[model samples]
Target chain A: MKITFPHMGNLYIAIEALLSELKFDLIIPPPSSKRTLTLGTKYSPETICLPLKLGVGNFLEGIELGADTGLMVGGRGPCRLGYYAALQQEILYDLGKEIEFIVLDHPKEDFVRFKSQIIPLIKAGGVKALAKGLALAWEKLVAVEKLERTAHYVRPREARPKAATQVLNRALQKLRHTNTVGGIRKLCRQECDHLRDLIDRNAQEPLKVGVVGEIYTILEPFANLDLEERLGYLGVEVLRTVSLVQWLKNNLILSSLGLYSNRWLRINARGYLHASVGGHGLESVARTVALAGQGYDGIIHILPFTCMPEIVAQCILPNVSVDYQIPVLSLVVDEHTGETGFQTRLEAFVDLLSRRGQGGLQHDSACISWS
Target chain B: MTAPVYLGVDVGSVSTNLVLLDAHSLEVADKVYVRTQGQPIRTLQRAMAKIARKNQWQIVGVGTTGSARQLAGVILGADVVKNEITAHAVAALHVEKGVQTIIEIGGQDSKMIILRDGVVSDFAMNTVCAAGTGSFLDQQAARLGIPIQDFGRIALRSRHPVRIAGRCTVFAESDMIHKQQLGHSLADILAGLCDAMVRNYLTNVGKGKEIRPKIVFQGGVAANQGMRRAFEAALNAEVIVPRHFDVMGAIGAALLASETICREGATRFHGFEITESVYQNHSWECQDCSNQCEIVDIVKDGRIIASWGSRCGKTDSSSEYGMLGAGN
Candidate 1:
């Protein structure tokens, strides 16, 4: 079967590999653009969320390019994403695209059930093949998570980022070409050594900034204007709350175990001073408090154009900034964003943090809003 | 001795738009729109060449917006690359001069901008659905075997409108087909579709809070008269479609470039010759830690200008001037 998947940030590479390993020809959606949005908007219902709309466009584009099967992520929660696969199937059927849908639901309650559900999709159905696919997927996720965590530590330090980057790229290249678990482990260890050495030596300090926001934009750099690296190059250390590891822990470990308190508890300890379901509200406030407690310079919250969860967080962020006596900048990106205006704000914010002595503790209760 | 001009291009999935404006007056000199058809570079190049041929315009400042803004910005040598909300609001402010509450919908997406004074106070975007958008109308017209161009005119003639399940596109489609199969008049069905589009738009895109007047409707879909009438009925007020309704995004982008050009005397816009250049991309894997970063390189004519795609600085390191390029 010609299997296809939507472009959700940087999921294409790993997904392509996994599907190809299973002997299925992978059809990737065209890059997400206005055309994808147009296709998605043309066929999808108006009430679905933006992410789903984007996903629809991706799938539709893939079908138009001759895809026969759709691989989708299914979830279980208050967040509407849990039921998106089913929702998208109905939407696509209405659009007149006949395709088999494989929804990978949360393995929280039953791995056996989840495995059984997916067993039919595999041509060579057995525990051995399942084990291989699961192991490869886990390896990919672990590889990506380790890199993201190491990035946060090394982003601010490396004097010439290109040097550290060269080492990382070489390692990733080797990993992508390898198939065995032992090969992945060997490659990872070698890369880790190089990255650790780069961090320990030839590192500089400008400012350390923690980033907290929605899951997609936080982990997916393309959606956020490469904000983390941009800050890193501006000599800022980036501490991101969302990573592949954290996502795995949430969906696979904590969520399945019903241990959801870590998120809320972490936020409360950070003094978010509010409760929010999603859109990184509690996380943003908590990250700010955590950064403040650690004496970091500032926090930048990145959100989508029309996200309800982020808007709630954006509204409450002012209080957190005031209470913690830290400078907070919220950047909301849509289809239309000015390059110059955005750059100017970044420069100004960095300058303000650099002059933390401008008001110091006396600047307590001051709210900073920049456009 | 002559003032410079800035070219701004706003390319969306539904339409491709271009605008040319004077550096000093910020007056819009020219504006045009065309269906995007998935190839932004071709669409933009065609738009630029058209504007240039018409006015004999000099190459100056350039700005890009919409989803392909970055690609356009890099290809066209844009001095400024911005998002659609900022570009739209900037353009709206220019036209209305402190107008508040702008309702902008295109073929694929719709947005509600609540402007307080001249600044954008609150805004929401419809990235998820098709109910309140142009695509919904397009689908209905196709099902009714009527050209979309004439779909709106017939809608305006309807005395009684049917009910469409505007909650979702699938439900809405089935409802429309059932209405047709039941021998409902074309006019009523058309009107029903319009009402559904309007209702879905307001509930989904315009979901919360007060929707004040000074409502401006613009976009490719804004050309639909039925949609306009539906909005009027839904809001219980008149809906204003600007003179340049279809090309507002381009106009806004042009206005932004004009502002920038006024501040900076000369423009850095690379001439139209950049069209034929072959843009190439190659990927490599970074072996740094457990995270093997996949690095992508952007090359034009075998000369690499930029590279990115790793979570960290794995391949494309940060370039000077805050612009990212191949690992320095």
Candidate 2:
């Protein structure tokens, strides 16, 4: 069966490796672009978040490319994401597009149904191929994550503008082509070294900004309008507070083993926000506190327009900003976000942080009033 | 002696302002403000011509700010190109050394800047909405059959102001019409509109921020005494409007240009001759990729002096032009 799934940064590279290794015919949708956004918005319900709309666009592109089945993940949460697959299916069916959907949810919820859905996909290669595919996918995932971290480090410190991004892009292209585990490992090391070598150690200390927000907006460059790259270009070192590996480790391995709760996050989020408000609301608050404690120069909170959980987090973020004494700029983006305005806000925020760093505004304890 | 002057130009959606600051005394040598009238390049040229005719000063540095800053910077050869927020904050601090807050309502945007110890502590700009800004007020004034300059005076005559919706411009307009149909006096309705705009600005742009003493109100809208009175009444605090409130962004640009020239020791000012030059601008869709970015080119004397609006950075050649083209 020909399978297709939505893109989430480099997650596609790992998924392509796994599915191809499993001997299943796969059709990867084109990278998210204006056309994808237009198609998604045209078909999607008026108030659904950006991720779901993009997913529908991916499915449409995949279908046009002759893919007959769509693959997605399901979750149980207060977030609207849990209902996206069902809604997308209805949307596709109404559009007269026929495709089988395989939504992989937590196995504990329905082990029998999960096994039934998994058996057919693995029928060709059996459990051995499944294990091998999983191993290869896992290695590639870790490799991309490492490459991303190195890119973040080298971007601000690089002697030349866009040098680190160029290396990272070339490395990502190589990783997408290379299938062998050894090839991926060697590429990860060589490219990371190349990235590090581009840095000018004598460069002035760059401002450190932590990016905390919804997972989709944080991981998907198209979704956040390449925010990390923009910050890096502005001479700020970006520290991402969310990643695919961390999320999977927490939700899949830890939760399945009944050891899911993050003590650090729980402790950090106390007094400000108690209990999971669903999605990444709690995680956003906790990470902001953690980043502040780590002495980040500033924080940028991004969320897709009309995102419920993120809206909740956005409301409470001002309090956190005041309490932590860290400047936080919350940007809500959608298809309508103008690049010029977005750039202006980013540049202003950077200027603010740099001035704060220079102690240009002498700190007066008596006159300081955030409220 | 031709005294050195730093030039600042603010090219906004509704207006273009130019300020010349004397290098020795750091005082405003001259200022020119003109309506943009949907043509920024021409508006900039006219304002520059006015300034050029007034003085034969040596421009040592040039800065540009506002919505069309990059365009103005390219055409004028600016030493520093800054955003409106920084430009406004810099201007406010210069006007009032101990200013704690600044309320700026411009043509298409409004901003609230909170300063602590003379440094910008926090700021908020209206996002994805243009309610209660200068353009909206201007439109309402025209609809009321009164010159925009008289709106503030009429508003001041009202003893009892009516209430209008300020959440959105459409709602505000409809509510104003409804209030007018209810036989309310024109002065009361105008006063109510000012109050609504102030309420909207405070709720949206000034949300959650501390409004303290030494508040400086500036921008094109700051000229409207109605808005000034509304802000004062709402906050229960006196608002200080600088003498050159309308051209604050331009003044700040000049200040920033001076700072950059002091550090860099070189000027990129193309001179006032550009004001008399012939310039042409046009946009075309690039067919290189599916993105199909609409790239705009500013042609001076048959040579493309500046090109921008391309997402892929392929058509961006703003730095290539060192001087006006041979056509000039």
Candidate 3:
């Protein structure tokens, strides 16, 4: 069976490593573009968030490429993500496209159902191949995260515009092609060094801003309009509050073991939010508070327009901003977001942060007023 | 002898404003305001020509702001090009030394900038909707058969104003008609519209923002006394409207240009002769990638001066035309 899945930044890299080792025929959908969004939107409910629409787009493209079975993850939470697979299945069926979906839910939630689903995949590849695939995928995920972190650090300090981005892109391309774990490790180090070399050591210290928000918007560049790259170009060092590797470690490994995941996040979020509002809502508040204490210049909270958890978090962020004395800009984005307006807000926010960092107004107070 | 002055241009969606500030004293020497009328180039050129005929001063520095800042900057060879938020905040601070909040409602956007100790602390602009901006108010005034200029004065005559929904323009329009059918006076209906708009702005653009005393209201909409009064009534605080409210964005741009020129030691002002030059803007879809970015070119005489709007930054007027033996 030809299998396919949705894309989420570098998650596809690790997924590819795992699937290829399983010896399953896979059709990786084309990288997301305007066409993908168009197809996705045409079939999706207008009020649904951007990620699901993009997910639908990915599935359609994969189906066109002869993918009959779709792979997706299911969750039990207040977030709508838990129902995404079912809804997508309905959409595809309504369009007269017959496709099977293998949704991997948490084993802890329903061990019997989870085992029934996972056993076949494991049997297809054998236990030894499954172990090897898991190890390779883990290695690739770690390598990818490290490379991305290095890219973020070097982006703002780079001497030339878009230099760090180019190096990161090249390295990611190579990482995709290189299959061996050792090769991935070696390539990551070399590319990271290359990114560092592009930095201008003599440049002024760049402003630091933490990005905290919904997981899908935070990780996907297209969903957030390349927020990190744009901020990097504006000379602000972006500190991503979420990473796929860290998330997996926290949610999958830690939570499945009946241990507390993101203990620090839970502790920090105590005063602001007592219980999980689900889908990274508590994490968003906790990260903002932590980043503020870390002396970050500002915080940018981004979410899809109809995102419920992030919307709840957005409402509480102002109090956090006021109490912590750190400025927070909440950006709600959708398909209709204009690039010019987005760019203007980012530029203005960066200007505000830099000016605040300078400790006063950039202009002389002695200037004459027209009024 | 002519004195050196800095020029600022704000090319907004509805109007274009130009301000000339004295170089040394930094005082406003001249200003011009004109409707953009969907043609920023022609509007800016006409404004520049008017300023050129009125003043004999030398423009030493130039800056541009507003929605079309980049286009205006390229046309004027501006020394500084900045966004409307920074420009508005700067101008508001200059007007009120201890200004804490700036309520700026322009042609198609509304903004709330919060300042703490002369530094902008937080700000928010209207997103995805222009429900209660200047254009909406202008349309309402036109539909009511009232000249937009007298909308504020007419609103002031109301004793009891009816409530109108301000969530959406379509809803607000129908609500106004409903209020009118219920035998409400024109003045009261206008006042109610203003209040509803103020409520919408507060909930949307000014959401979660600290609206402290020393609130400075400036922008094209500030000219409407009804909006100013509505804001005052809602906040229960005195709203200060600056003398040159309509052109504050332009004034701020000029001030920024002056600052840049003082530090950088030179100006990029292309001089007033650009008023006589014929410029044409052209846009075409680049099929080099799936992105299919529409690249725009600003052609001055026969030479392309600037090109933008490509995602990859590869498509340029020079390279595309040079291959066809067209570029200089």
Candidate 4:
């Protein structure tokens, strides 16, 4: 049997190990990129959110590369991401791409049906095999958590940045090549520890910056133009909204915690800000709130232009800044967000923040001697 | 001193619109549209130059809208920057006291907006389709060797508009050609193309919506009488096209600026000199991590005014700047 899962922050880390133990072949989509966007845009209705298009592209690409089964998450949210799976399935079918659509629908309301559907996919010949799969999945999840924690610090100060990246890449390569949970865990820890050591020794200064935006853009590097590393270079420590641990908790345990009464939890104040109605703006607002609370110097809300939710947030962010006294910068990305224009804005915002940091705006600071 | 005027600019892919509204009277002083020939900066500069020459009023406030709003805002020193939906809806409200619907079709994009009272209730935009946009009609007009300006007049003359496939641009193009080869008159073919585009729009862009009759079609494509006829035929009702239809986005932006000025009782418009201001951009790659976010900077007077294009906030540490001395 073949089992596949959608790429979440660290979803594969846990499930891939278990699936491998069960002897199920796995198909993972390549990292998100413009190629994925083009693929999704070519097939998807132009009106849908960018993430859905990319997800569809990712799935279709994986399928073309030789997978019959595709796993997708189902959710209910204001962002309309909840409708993506069914719509994607319909579009894929229309495009004549045949695949087993395994939608892990919200298990709370559809618990019985979800279990019934999943049972067939599981290796059901023996209970021992199921137990082994569960155990392997657990190990993989733990490894992913550790990897992410180490990754959070590795970007800004790498003793040997290339070598550290090589370690992580080597671990991923080793994991992809092997089905054994133990083998993957061994490589991940070894690589992670080596990278962690490098990061720990080379740390000089860290700038603290907050990233807030739509779930897809914030989490998906390809979508957001990789803001984290840019800030990290400016000596910023990246505080992300979607962590591997939180992702697992949201998808696994807390998913059905309040399924009937509260289907969607307003989680991740650090990034999934809530300020706008239809776009990623609200999420950016929430991120601003969290960053302000954490005493971050500045906040950047990244979102696509014409995104309704972010637009709504943009309208309210000025007010949000006034209330919190946080200087919030909104970056509306599009196909035409040329790199030069983007860099200028980043440098200016950083300079603005630096000026503020040096007590330029503080009434009490006596440093302003008008020369 | 006389109250200053507010300058609003709407720069879309196909056209650049400029509007000047009197701050006190809130009346539109003047408005202009120029084709955006793949260069928004030049179009905006040219429009600003024209408005500056024609109107002797001092600019107190600047607002921007449409697709390249951010770029325009930076270039114009805009006090207010808004999206096309808000701008269109605002302009529609100014024209019609109780506009309930707004159908906007531009060169590269199309939108369906539902309004209640003067506010936008719901809206949908089509950005990734050439099938139901002005470009589609332009292509059809060229294929038939019909001047684009006369397409509407000829389409209105058609007694029996033929049916053409409209799901995809390729299919529609092929179908239009086949109908032409089948001895259909140019007017019939043009009308058929218009009908097909409208059909495609309703099915795809305008799907699952209650399109009320108190509708106003505004945008670059709203000037096309063929589309107006097609919409009228498709809905079996007359669709109102605003007088300053093509530049509604700019009008709405002007209205927004006017409203703000009314509330604040002052204008901070940088004036027409901004048109001559040097606007430049530069970029660098962030090698901080695996995700190499390209950082972009917008420069004015050799100083970085704005910087963005980062996924993780690594390159631009605005958040950290907020907290640097909080504890000290």
Chain A TM-score of prediction number 3: 0.96
lDDT of each: 0.69, 0.85, 0.86, 0.67
Q: Per-residue lDDT tens digits of candidate 2, residues A1-371?
A: 89998888889988988888889899999888878889999999988899999999999999999999999887678888877888888899999999889888777666676777788878867888888888888888999999999889887788866678768877988998888889889999999999999999898888999999998989988888888877886788999888788888887778778888777777998988887877898889999998999999999999998888888888888999999999999998888746767877887888888888888654333221111
- Which residue runs of candidate 4 sit more than 4 Å off their true CA positions? A1-6, A12-31, A35-371, B1-3, B314-328
| Residue A122 displacement in candidate 2 (angstroms) | 1.9
Quote each prediction's TM-score.
0.57, 0.93, 0.94, 0.57
Q: Give the winner by DockQ: 1 or 3.
A: 3
What ordering of candidates by lDDT runs from best to worst?
3, 2, 1, 4
Q: lDDT (0-100) at residue A28 of candidate 4?
A: 69
Mark the regions of model 3 whose C-alpha exceeds 4 Å error after superposition: A362-371, B276-294, B302-304, B310-328
Candidate 2 residue B110 C-alpha distance from true site, Å? 0.8
List the candidate numbers ranked by DockQ, top first.
Answer: 3, 2, 1, 4
Instruction: Pick the winner on DockQ between candidates 1 and 4.
Output: 1
Docking class of 2: acceptable
Q: Report the C-alpha lDDT of model 2 over B1-328, residue by residue, as the tens digit.
A: 6778989899988889999998866689888889899999989988888877767788999988888887888889988888888888888887778899999989888999888887788899998689989999999999999999999999999999999999999999999999999999999999999999999999998988989989999998998998899999999999999999999999888988888787678898888889978889989999875446667898987889888665445566737332111000
Q: Which stretches of candidate 2 lie over 4 Å from their true place?
A: A109-113, A362-371, B276-328
Writing each residue's lDDT as its tens digit, candidate 3 over A183-216 gives: 8889888888898999898987989999999999
> Which RMSD does model 1 reach against the true structure?
11.3
